[model samples]
Target: MDYRMFKHRMVNIVERMKAIGGNVSEVMIGAPASLQQIEACEIKLGFQIPESFKKVLLEFSSSCNLRWVFPDEYQLAGELDGIFSGMLHWDLALLKELNDDKNGWVKEVFSNPDDEYDKVWHQTLAFYEVGNGDYIAFDLVDNSTDACVIYLSHDDGEGHGYKLADNFIDFLEKWARIAFVGGEDWQWLLFTSNAQSGLLPDSQSAKLFRSLLKLSI
Candidate 1:
């Protein structure tokens, strides 16, 4: 999408999310990094990320500092579709650190999402397992509005457990950290693709969300 169109949509979404108690500190339409930045990052990581994914880094960069605005609260409802398909979440402090041209920390944080893309919980959980031993999962959710949602499952046979993040950054940080680890037995999943399910209540879902929010902070 063009920057102008993207920015307008983002403003509308952010306002709506805020109405529902979402905490969105900053919004970016295109990749926050430049080409030279990405090249330097690739060298630091010792591998290349998918071009499709890199397109994201080339296009948009977003930061949702949930803690700053919410203090200790996080949204509970999960949206229907994937809001952060290409973007990655970076904390404000981290953003500055990574964005610094001298250190080139931003280049280093860019990572490939793993293959286990199936498991997620709108306003709850999401995961991915790259290969080797790298893995990431959303243990909880902080935001639940039109801007973003999550759907995840527990390993238990009953599918009785799941969680979501209040904002995209929360979700990204959870998974991104794991992807950065890179492992062989990494048997988890994380995805930024087209989400399949629509919004659904988890039966006592509000209670679960409130509980998770308290835990997230």
Candidate 2:
């Protein structure tokens, strides 16, 4: 996927999010990282960062503060913060710190080598914390490109990791759709209610929803 196109699409999504009462100011999009900083992270982690993931970090090292415009009823409801929020993407420095062999949380979580789950964690790179100790990471063992998005849930006993998407772009696109358009069940409910209640003009809601839909496509 074209990085430029992906960035452009994300910018458009943020703008629309603002239109629907999202707190744009609360959103923290960090400055792009330098090549030196990127290389430092790679060296520290001992594994090459996927090109797709690196492209996103180069554009915005960290992004956060995205919230649902509507009330809880209209939201997907999860312990994790909004995907657009910086919470999903770690700062390059933070990523390195998190992967530190001696002081990293990864070591603590994967301490039991005998445990199967801990073994899986060994081959993955934990880039984003999904609150409650869960993480969104890259499954280095399963995908040769090391781009597949996976969810590692520390809280989930036994069976923890789950594949989220095939790549970072796919993950981002899904995140945008769920955030703006709502999930499979919620999307229809949100659109119908907003249109009927005139909370958002029908035409406007339809337009924004259409724009969001196209992003996923």
Point out where model 2 deviates above 4 Å. 1-25, 59-65, 69-88, 100-106, 157-159, 180-217
Cα distance off (Å), candidate 1, residue 138 = 15
Model 2 residue 161 CA deviation (Å) reads 1.2
Query: Which regions of candidate 1 deviate over 4 angstroms?
Result: 20-31, 59-217
Q: How much lDDT does each candidate structure score?
A: 0.32, 0.52
In the order shown, what is each candidate's alpha-carbon RMSD? Answer: 13.7, 9.0
Which residue pairs of candidate 2 clash? 63-85, 63-86, 64-85, 64-86
Q: Assess candidate 1 and give its TM-score to the true structure.
A: 0.33
Candidate 1 C-alpha lDDT tens digits along 122-204: 22222232122222233323332222323322232122222333334443433332221111111111222123221122224
In candidate 2, position 61 carries an lDDT of 55
lDDT of 1: 0.32
